[model samples]
Target: MVEITNMCRTTGCAIGDIKLYCAGFTSANLINPLIFRHLPTPNHDYCIVNNGNPLSAGAVLSFHYDNTFMYRDFSVSTVTCIS
Candidate 1:
């Protein structure tokens, strides 16, 4: 994680295409979200998990199945770029 507490910028990447990287800022897996949205706050951080574990919060994640996109809650969670 890059600790993207302030360096969140949604640019260059295309819609449905996630640009967040992992530990080494490795190549980001291109996720085509059927529907996406922020978690109330504004940031470019996101998480895409196909496993059963639900994402904590603080990101723009679309579960594809739920068709729901969640962002950081601020009060409870920070910017978790990946799950």
Candidate 2:
């Protein structure tokens, strides 16, 4: 298990990004999210399970999720960025 933290960048802004890799494997699973406004402040919950194998060193992973919780037009969630 690994935890990553970073600041917001205009060039590549990923509020929440997640990536999973299998140890001793060459391929990886990528999970990129669409950030939505008016969703919920600290309202989203994400969990990943690795059934094949545990992750090892030098494994690459990437993911992005929305953090905004409110919007003026709609009460539903909306994605601000996707990459």
Q: Go through the candidates in order and give each one's C-alpha lDDT.
A: 0.30, 0.28
Task: Name the regions of candidate 1 deviating beyond 4 angstroms.
Answer: 1-41, 51-83
**Which residue pairs show collisions in model 2?**
17-63, 18-63, 35-79, 36-78, 36-79, 38-69, 38-70
Question: After aligning candidate 2 to the native by TM-score, how far in Å is the CA of 53 from where it should be?
Answer: 3.7
Candidate 1 lDDT over 1-83, as tens digits, reads 12322233454322222323222111234333332222222343433232222233333443322213332332312223432
Off by over 4 Å in 2: 1-46, 49-52, 69-83
Q: Encode model 2's per-residue lDDT on 1-83: one tens digit a residue.
A: 22333233443443232322222211133333231111122532222222222223333333333334321221212213333
Q: For candidate 1, which ten residues in a row score worst on lDDT?
A: 18-27
The all-Cα superposition gives candidate 2 an RMSD in Å to the true structure of 15.8
Winning candidate number (TM-score) = 2
Error of 2 at 38 (Å): 20
Score residue 12 of candidate 1 by CA lDDT. Answer: 35
Per-candidate clashes, comma-separated: 4, 7
